[model samples]
Target: MDASASPAAAAPDPASTPGPGPVPPPAPVSRLRRLAVPVGAMAAAVAAFGYVAAVDPNEPGHYPVCPMLRFTGLLCPGCGGLRSAHAFAHGDLATALGSNALAVVGYVVLAVVWLLWTVRASRGRPLRIGVAPVYWWGIGAVLLVFSVVRNLPFGSALAP
Candidate 1:
C-alpha cells in the first residue's frame, strides 16, 4: 500500500510507445531548379526591353495614349512610362528622366529588387518583399504628387 510501490508510478518505456519516427531532412534543390524563376523573369524583362528599344513610343501610335491624359488633359503617373522605358533602354538617361523621373526611379528599384530576388533564389532561399501598407500608401502619395507637379507649368521639366 506504499505510494512508492504503486503501478501507476512506473515510467513507460519509450521503445514500447508508438510515436512518429524522426523526420527526414528536406531534399536538396538542383541548381537549375533553384535559378529557374529568376532567370525566366529576367529573360522576359530583357525581351520586353528589347522590343521597346527597337520600337519607338514617341511616335504616338506605337503605344496607347493614357486615358487620363486623352480624356481630361490630366497626366497620370504612368502617362509617359513607355517613352521613359524606351529612352532608358537606349541609354538616354537624360531623356528618360525628362520623360518620367518616377519611371526611371522605378527601373532602378526594379533592378535592385530583381537583383535581391535572383541572389536569394540562387541561394535556395525564399525572396521576401514584405513592404508595409503604410509604405505602399506613401509610394502612392509620392506618385500622385509627381503626377500633379509634372502637369503644372512650374514643373514643365517633368512633363514628357
Candidate 2:
C-alpha cells in the first residue's frame, strides 16, 4: 500500500466493490409495437378490397370509364382490375378473369406473397422482397403485350 493513498481506498471492501454480477436480460417487446405494422397493412389491403367490391365498375357512371378505352377503343392492362377484384371477392372466378386476366393473376400472386409474409413475420423474421431484374422486366413485357394485344381488333376477346 502507498502511504499517500486514502485509508478508504487502501483497504479492499467487499461491500463497496463493483464486479460483473448476473445481468438482467432485456425486456420483451410490447405486443402493440410488434404487431402494429402487419395489422395496419392488412387493414389497408382489406379496406381497399372492400371499397373496390362495393363500387361497381361495370355500372357505367359509378366509376370513371377508362379514358384509353374510350379514345383508342382498347383495353389497357389495368382497365378492369377493380371489377376483377369485385368478382373475385364474390367468388365469381370466371367473371373476374373476364374482367381482367392480368388482375386475376396479380391477385393470386399477391395472395401467395401475403401468405409467405405472414408466416415469416409470425416466425420473427423480417419481410423479404426478392425479385430479380429479369423477372421485373418479364412482368413489364407481359403487361405491354397485354395492353397492345387488347387494343388490336384481333385480340377483341382480351378487351374489357
Clash tally, candidates in order: 0, 0
lDDT of each: 0.91, 0.83
TM-score of 2: 0.75
By lDDT, who's the top model here?
Answer: 1
* Off by more than 4 A, model 2: 1-27, 30-32
Instruction: Give the Cα-based TM-score of candidate 1 against the true structure.
Output: 0.84
Whole-structure CA lDDT of model 2: 0.83
Alpha-carbon RMSD to native, per candidate = 3.7, 6.1
What tens digits encode model 2's per-residue C-alpha lDDT throughout 8-112?
Answer: 667988866898877899897665666667877878988988887888777878788779878977678999888889898888999999888999999888878
With candidate 1 superimposed using the best TM-score fit, by how many Å does residue 72's alpha carbon deviate from the native? 0.6
Q: Which residue runs does candidate 1 get wrong by more than 4 Å?
A: 1-23
lDDT of 1 at 103: 92
